[model samples]
Target: MPRPRTVLLTGAAGGLGTLMRGLLPAYGYELRLLDVLPIPDEPAAITADLADKDALRAAVHGVDAVLHLAGISLEASFDKILRANIEGTYNLYEAARAEGVRRIVFASSNHAVGFTPRPMGTDPLIPVATPHRPDTFYGLSKAFGEDLAQFYWDKHGLETVSVRIGSCFAEPTSVRMLSVWMSPDDGARLFDAALTAERVGHTVVYGSSANTRLWWDLASARALGYEPRDDSEPYAEKLLAEQGELDPERPEHACLGGHFTTDPPIWPH
Candidate 1:
């Protein structure tokens, strides 16, 4: 398929969405913004919950693809996770399918495989095909999103790229982040590649920069024309010095999802 010129960017008011808003336009995409919360500067951004089927269908209409960044990002109760991440993603897919939109870049998080062991010294990088061992309801929701993406592809002929993103921040702040951090610029590059790749057919790829301490493989991402230009190496010395290196014996450090694996937040009553 030709390059997608117009995209519906969900979660427009969230941190990653806000960062992407400043970045993706450089690649020539005209973004249609959507969020449950109000977008600060843009008057035209769609303001509605994902459960609003009519609004979701309308948001997807005329857009070439969707960058699905909406939903509750952190660990939440099963009820919240169901409404925001699981059902919300399902709603988005139905809307996209109903509108005849072809491609969607789903923001599947690393926490989806939060219990998988991290690569240690000379250990093979974690493969994209790792089995699901979700540590929290939030992670379980992401795993469900991947399945949802696959079902949409097989049953409805829609294409999706399930990006299992790591810590996408301006800089690495923790010892674990040194291994998982994806710079904002590299995040944009990966998303751009996902948007333009041909015959993706529900491809799942890990998202992060070329970090020296990377725990997972980026080969899948690279195969989609994603050439990451940044690395978390420069931040290594500072983070390591402050927090010290991760100990494999520690449960959190042993897994790819860090604290989400060993110390997930307790669900609220």
Candidate 2:
């Protein structure tokens, strides 16, 4: 198989974005990093807002595929989510379509399926291929992106994969993370599968690891040849003891993972 040559990556300044920028280059993809903030060290970084059609169009120029990571990520006011996540996503899709870009690997979030409940005893509870049950505005935006991917694939023939990413920290920090954390290596592999998978017209897969305590299954992503390495169970004992009490809510305790289903909003402004 021919290697993915040139990829246009957005949101390079963010955590996962930075990791992807570092890893993608090593995987033989000539990276064109994009973000509103300047990343001087990135070889081909472009400073632009994805919501701007003209800027997004310019960013999409001459790229074979787009690993779209740009967007607002918090469960804030509806207006904020609309402009950054919704509109920005639309601009990227339309721009990719116009540029004749064949593939799009979108950075959808676990929050897209956040509302799904998982019982405490079951580790492999929330299967990755399950239907979306978005919990917040941020998650709703991701749901929209997934639908948009379907629209683009059905109407414009653009191959797209919406990866509902879990916690992508350096290490599993809390009890819930034992079920939801996505190691950097696993995250990169997921992106690779999304980029190079054959006949993936439109698909949704969970972005997570092969953890023994994981709440999600990777059958969908397995078809794309993704084999994740890391497991969060190694830190399970330490995390659960440290995190104090687990929430009483079934949605909070169940496989869906995290406070995405909680009453009080937890996103930073």
Candidate 3:
């Protein structure tokens, strides 16, 4: 299929969403922003929860594709994760199907496989086929999203790219981030690739830059024509100097999920 010109950008007020809002327009995409939170300058944004079927349908209407980035981003209580991530993603897919939007770029997170052991000596790069080992309720919700995308593709013939994003920031902030940080420029490039790739039937790819210390494989993403332009190596010296070296014995450093692995899981009363 040809690249989509008009796309629905959910979670427009969120951090990554806000970044894409400023960048995607340069790629010739007309974005229809949606979020429960009001976008600062986008007065035309669809201000509604994803659970609102009517509003969601309206948001999906006439859009050629959807960039689903809405939902809980952190390790929130299970109830919150269920309501916002699980139910919200389902509602979005239903709306997309009903509105005849075939292509979607789901903003999945590395948390989906957060429990995977970090690479040790001679450990192979983490592949896209890695089994689910979610570290938290938030991570579990992302796993559900991936499966949801797969089901839509199998049953409804919808196309999706579930990007298991690592740390997407301007630069690496910690020693652990050196293996996972994705530059903002590369993030935009990957999303563009995911949106434009042909014949991607619910593909999943690790969303990180071509860092020297990268833990996950980028072959899947590369197959979609995603060529990341940055690396976290340059930031390594400063980060390591400030934060010191990673201690493999620590649970936070022993897994890809970092602090998420050791933090007490939150739950709703």
Q: Among these predicted structures, which one has the highest lDDT?
A: 1
| lDDT, model 2 | 0.83
In candidate 3, stretches whose alpha carbon ends up further than 4 angstroms from where it belongs are 264-269
lDDT of 2 at 23: 78
Please give the ranking of all candidate structures by TM-score, highest first, separated by commas: 1, 3, 2
lDDT of 2 by residue, 1-269 (tens): 24468899999898889888777777778888899789867656789887678988988889889999888766778888898899989999999999998999999988888877664563345666678788888899999999999999999999898898888878988877776789998898889888988889998888889877666767888889999999988898877787764675555664363566665264454
Shift of residue 15 alpha carbon in model 3, Å: 0.4
Q: In angstroms, what RMSD does candidate 3 have relative to the true structure?
A: 1.8
Off by over 4 Å in 2: 119-124, 244-251, 254-257, 263-269
Per residue, candidate 3 scores C-alpha lDDT tens digits across 148-252 of 999999999999999999988888889999999998889999999999999999999999999999999999999999999999999988988899988999999
lDDT of 1 by residue, 1-269 (tens): 79999999999899999999999999999999999999988999999999999999999999999999999888887899999999899999999999999999999999999999888889999999999988789999999999999999999999999999998999988989888899999999999999999999999999999988888999999999999989899988887788888888989888888898756765542
List the lowest-lDDT window of 10 residues for candidate 1: 260-269
**Pairs in clash, predicted candidate 3:** none
Model 2, position 249, has a per-residue lDDT of 50
